[model samples]
Target chain A: MDILRIATSGSVDDGKSTLIGRLLYETGQVPTDRMQQIEESSKRRGLSFTDLSLLTDGLISEREQGITIDVAHIYFHTPARKYIIADTPGHEEYTRNMVTGASQSEVAITLIDARYGMLEQTRRHLHIAHLLKMSNLIVAINKMDLVGYERSAFEAIKSEVESYVNQLGASFTLHFIPMSALHGEGVTAFKDGLSWYQGAPLLDILESIKPRNIINAEGQTNFQVQQVLRPRGGDDPDFRGYAGSLRTGSIRVGDEIQVLSTGKSSTVVGVHKWGTELNASGPDQALTVLLADDIDLRRGDALIAKENDLATSRRMTASICWMDEQPMTSRKKYIYQQGSFSTKIMVDQIQGTVNLKNGELKSNHQVLLNEIAKATFKSASAIPAIEYQEGNSTGAFALIDEQSLNTVAVGFAERFA
Target chain B: MKISDFPRSLENEAIYIFRETLAQFERPVLLFSGGKDSITLVHLMLRAFHPLVPPIPLLHIDTGHNFPEALRFRDELVEKYQLTLHVRKVEDTIREKGLQEETGKYASRNALQAVTLLDAIEEFKFDACIGGARRDEEKARAKERIFSVRNDFGEWDSRRQRPEVFDILNGRIHPGENVRVFPISNWTELDVWNYIREEGIALPSLYFAHEREVFYRDGLIWPVSDFIRLSQDESPERKVVRFRTVGDMTCTAAVDSQAATIDLVMEEIAAAEISERGARIDDKRSEAAMELRKQNGYF
Candidate 1:
């Protein structure tokens, strides 16, 4: 099944969790007994209806505080598509979490309250989504019922968001949907009772969507070999293949691929899917590939298209979201772990923090926790960095703490102009 | 469509966690109980580092009253793949007076395994322990994180969990502290069966149909064993049955099944009307049995 990954962002009490829960419930992905528990809890709490937010807010503290503390992954499948919702906390301190969820997501649904359209938290979420290079965005103007479903209120919010979104450096296809998660107005497969609006339901919009075609500009495949399989006498002999998932582009039988760091060239002799043999392999196909020519490639090495060098550069300028409690310091030594490869790197510069609202770049020396900033920094040595704008695996990375060995921040290497 | 072609977000997340554990921790072990969920976890661990040796080892905490097939399957997998297999026996723990064997018809040593597990962790100094716990199995598990922290005494502090965001798992454990990692915490029981069938992974024969000395107790098929002592009112008998959950034999119940092959077992699982953990008598011991077990580091 084609996966539709959506990252949801909004402040607490904006009904982000409720919207996600309603989407899953309307799609019939929730188990029956689990639903019964929620029903009973609602009754105990003396509520007239079940609280859908309880589904995604899974942590013990979150339930106790009635807020999401971290990014909890919630999965629900419909007949048309399987959805993975990386539900992030809406608090200002959790901006790192909002960025973390947005890093892997293809589409971002930024929720704004119709009663309080485009608050500080709303701008922060939208800014984080844009900075993460999320291609598709939906500006969900939520809680129309609270404001008597006023059309003017919805329109005012829509234009205000569009005017801000149009100026974003990271361009995203945008849409606006006005709905009330409390009353189940337009968030699911339900027909719009308010005929003031004309459009597909949220489910239809989410299901019919195909992730934007990822065309690696230079027509290349960055097949970094993770492991080399050499069976001495098991089954077949002379069977040597560099095994790693295709991280960037596609490779077919006749395509000429290059083994980076070695300058060796070979035709794609075969593509081995995890257990099954295949004719071609593309991005995210965690498979083994056999090249006609035997070349030395280990973990952290890239197999680029013979002529395509788009993702092979070593220097990177990136927008980073600091997640650790420790503030970002310049030239601090840390490990740069991208995919299966880990190498030592030092942060050379702390460029500037993002203003978020007006896309204004504020010059700064460093960033603190939950802060987003764009920096131009050189690797301690040299490492491969494609623009995080293209490849999912290569373009992104996390800075490993030198002392604690914990990953502190998720970063997107800025695309070379 | 090839299962490999399509990826479940939960499965990808689990694989990522498994790899991260291998890369980050010094000594990690996967707690295998010979159940379908753990079996699926084994397969995922294998694929996570395919072409290379599996990074970590597999540990089985034998309750001694396990089905013969489960024991045999554990050995076969070790011998077949040349995997690092470590077996810790509860029988030894009982003989050494580390745990007391329960008495009476309703008596079970399911809770006592925690003591033996803590002993093993202390012996090995394992930093991270991975298991096949799923959220849908129980309420507390649904409340767990991918990387759950444990104290020096191997106790889960429910009040204090480091926030997990994106793929960044906080495997931070202070000295003498260990982390309990559940890679498949998001998968449902059906996902495990589907993955096993899809991958054609080997499983214990006890999961399939077989003749076993069993008796009915409290609407469950209780395996007849010296440890699984039966009531005077009931008689030991042989019946065609299979274990749905390969927990401790005293608490683990058998379900009536004729399906033997992986495909048939999956079909049966899909059509079955009961939860996989429903057959576990230990869980039925209390509303929060699993939660308390987790707090005590029962992984």
Candidate 2:
């Protein structure tokens, strides 16, 4: 069975945890003893109904504060596929945590309380998902039981979200499901409500959706060299392989490739995936390629197709999400970790922060915590960068503070400035 | 349309993590415990650097109360692979520090291994220590990142952890600070068993069912050990059992099962109700036992 990773974002009381618990309960994934424990905790809390959120709020701080502060990964499986849900916090201060959850996910689900309609938090999540290129979205309109299962209420929120999507110019395969997570309605199947709605249930939609396609499906092979392996004289002594995962496209034994950083050339002598020697290697596979020539290669160097030399420059403009408590300003030095390469970088300019409520790029010099902005930077080394629109893995990078050594920001390349 | 269209397998993901660790850290060591998960890691390490021994060394913190079978298996693998093995003893540290061992039925040296682990880290100056900790084992581990950073004092600060985005891991740290990398953090117990069967990896004899001297406690089978202080009424009984996890004899628990082969073990794991760590007596100490131990540099 294939694996589908989903990122879930919802505020504290949006019944996000309840929705997940209901999913687990419906699929019979929660064991009997665990369910009994939840029941006992619910009774201790003096709730007439079981508090399903108790399952997801695992941390003591979260249980004490009654709010999720970080992301928790929950796993479940069906006959057709396995699923991993990256449950992220909804508070604004924890926006960085949400980004972490969404980074590796192919689909994003945003939960909306039926009464609140569309809040700023909803827009913020949608914007981040779009920025991350999440292909499919499920705007779950929850708490339909409280709204009398009215079809108009669900339609009202759907239209409002559609308008925001249009303004942002984000093209996502959007699906809206109206249900009560507490009652397990419209999650896997609908019952006794929303006769006006004619669509598959949430689980059906999830199973039917295909894995997100890479943007440049036909892009050339771009392999980043992670480590160099040399076996000291033993059984098979003449083995030297460059180990890394293929970010895009494929490579064969005789394919000629060029180093992106050093501009050297070599022919692939061997393509090894773990132990076996494969004729070719595909995307996302960890492979070790033996080269025909002994070239000067180091970590963070890339081996690209001979015909495809990525744009290399020392300066680039990018959309940055500031995650540190210290505000980011021009002329500050930080370490830029791009793929396996790390280089010292200085912020050349801070254009502005992007406002999610309205699709506007406001002009600002300072980017504070939990703020998304456009910025330009100059790296000490000539790094190979591709525009994020081209679906390049090297386009994404993280900035670590010089003094604290904390990753302060995540950025995606926009253009060569 | 084809098998190639599917997402990456858990093996590929783990291999990716291993390569990343080798690329990012200067001095990295693999923490081997002779358990299935860590043994699986050893197998992957071989494939990851095929035809060659991995540059990384294996570090084992011996608690002086380990199952004899586990120690034998560890030595056999070390000799077969011709790999470097470093052993640190908790008993030496216990004697040097003059610490008192618990004198009850549930006395364990599991928690005391933290002191020895931190001391080894300081001695080796290892920038990264890779382990086989999976999130599905315990609640505290559910929130751990693939690359967990530790402070200079070897403490875990889960509250302010760095946000790891996509496949890019930030291994930058201060001089004394080291990172703990969990390559199989997303894998489940069933997945581990399936991989073990698929890869045909060999494990310790304790993993298979055998007749052994054991006693019952808290609905779990405890192996007879000198470290454990049994009550007056408790007596050892022979039962056909196999260990689900391997740790110190005082803390690890066994379960009654006739499933000896890898296939049967996989089936048993699929039908099991509780988590693999449910039988661990150390985690049963308190609500935040794992968290407290992790904060004090326990792997």
Candidate 3:
């Protein structure tokens, strides 16, 4: 079975954890010991019912504060697919954590409390998800029982989210499900309460949804060399292979590829995975390619299809999400890393910070923690990059503080010059 | 789809991580525990650099209170792969460093493995320690980054962890500081078992059911061994049991099962209600037991 990675985001008390716990419990993924632990903890806390939120609040501080502070990955599997839920924090201060969770996920599940309509934090969550280019947007209007399971309340919130998503110009598949995770209504199997609603339950929607093939859009092959394997005494002596993961598109044997750094061309003689040779390999598979002519290829070098060309420039405009506590300023050099390549870069200008309230970029010179901004960067060396919309894997980069060595910001390439 | 047609995405991710670690770190070592997860790591590493054995070595911090079968398997694996193996004994660390060993029933050297591991890291100057930790195993591990960085003292600061975005990992660190890389952080226990079954990877015999003298305690079955100090109220009983996770004999618990093969073990895991770590005695100490241990440099 294939794996589906889902990121859950929303405002605090939106029951993101509870919804996840309900999903796990309904699917029989919650082990007996964990269920008992939750049971005992609920009783100790003087609650008559089991608190499913206790399952995802793994940290002691989170349990004490009754809030999620970081991203916690929860895993479960059905016969159809293995699901990985990145339960992200909802607080505005932890927006970076939400981005961290949604960055690797293909689907984004935005939870909305039925009692309260779309809050500012909810909009922020949706904005970040859209910025990350999530293929599927699952809007789960939870706590329907709190609102008396009224179809009007669900419709109100559904229309609000739809209008806002339209303003954001989202390109993903939007799905709205009304459910009460606490009471287990409309989660796995729809109960009798929602007679007005006629739709598949949340679990069914997840299982049936296919993760969009973002890589095969243009059939543009972008492979970065991570390592070079050479065995002198092996059966085939004088063997040299360039090993890396195919970030985008597919590669086949006898395909002509261009080395990004040197601009040299070579024919792919062999495509090997593990110890066996494959006739062809698709995106995301880690394989080694044997070039017909042994040209100079090292780590951080890219192998692109001869027909495709990546933007190579020392200046780049990107969308930056600041993650560190220290505010970012201009002319501060940071280590900009994309794939295996690393180079020193400085933020030349902070164009504007994104207005989460309206999904618009606002003029701002300084970026504080958890703030998203559009900025231009000047790298010490020319770098190969692509638009983030075109290639998520190859277009994204991280900026690490030179002194602290902490990842301070994550950027997506928009244009290169 | 048949089991053979299962998606190899997880394997691809793991191999990608292995290659990244090899390229980034100068002196990297795989923390081999003779468990299924670490065994799977070795297999992935071998596959990652095909036609060439992974240059990284294996480090096994031997807690003396280990299952004999696991040790035997470890030796056989090292020999089979012709890989370099480093064994640092907690027993030796305790003797040399004058570290106090816990006493009484449930007293285990599991916590003491941290000191030996730090000492080994310092000795070899290993910049990166590749582990088999998965997020689904426990709560604290769920929040851990794929490239978890440790201080010069090997302390894990969960609160100030660097943000890991997308597939790009930042492995940059300072001198005397090391990073603990977990390649299979996304994989669940069942995923590991499925991969093992698909790949037909060999594991220690302890994973399979065998007749052993065990005693029931605190709703768990403890093996009757010299390392464990059993109380007088508890008596040893012979039963067919298999271990879900292999750790120190004093900490790892056994479950009653007749799964003697990989397929049977997978079926048993799928049907079993208790989690893989549920049988572990150390984690039962408290809710933040793993977190506390991890902060002190425990793997």
Tens digit of per-residue lDDT, candidate 3, span B1-299: 23433457888888999999999999999999989999999999899888886688999999998889999999998999888999999999999999999988779988899999999999999999999999999999999989999999999987677788988899989999999999999988878888888888998989999999999999899999988777789999999999999988999999999999888887788888898899999999998899899999998
Best by DockQ: 3
Ranking by lDDT: 3, 2, 1
Tens-place lDDT per residue, model 1, A198-271, is 87667777876785433432335777655676656656667886666565567767778776666678888877
Superior by TM-score: candidate 1 or candidate 3? 3
Residue B90, candidate 2: C-alpha displacement in angstroms: 1.7
- Off by more than 4 A, model 1: A189-196, A211-219, A228-241, A252-256, A262-277, A289-296, A311-314, A415-417, B1-28, B45-56, B91-115, B125-130, B134-188, B205-244, B250-292
Better of 2 and 3 by lDDT: 3
lDDT tens digits, residue span A267-292, model 2: 99888876677865444678888999
- What value does the lDDT take at residue A32 in candidate 3? 89
Error of 2 at B46 (Å): 1.6
Per-candidate fnat, comma-separated: 0.09, 0.57, 0.82
For each candidate, the alpha-carbon lDDT, in order, equals: 0.73, 0.84, 0.88
TM-score, one value per model: 0.84, 0.95, 0.96
lDDT of 3: 0.88
In the order shown, the chain A TM-scores of the predictions are 0.91, 0.96, 0.94
Candidate 2 at residue A74, lDDT?
A: 84
- Candidate 3 lDDT over residue span A97-128, tens digit each: 88889888889999999999899899877877
Error of 2 at A295 (Å): 1.6
Runs in model 2 deviating more than 4 A are: A193-196, A213-218, A235-238, A389-392, B1-8
Candidate 1 colliding pairs: A317-A414
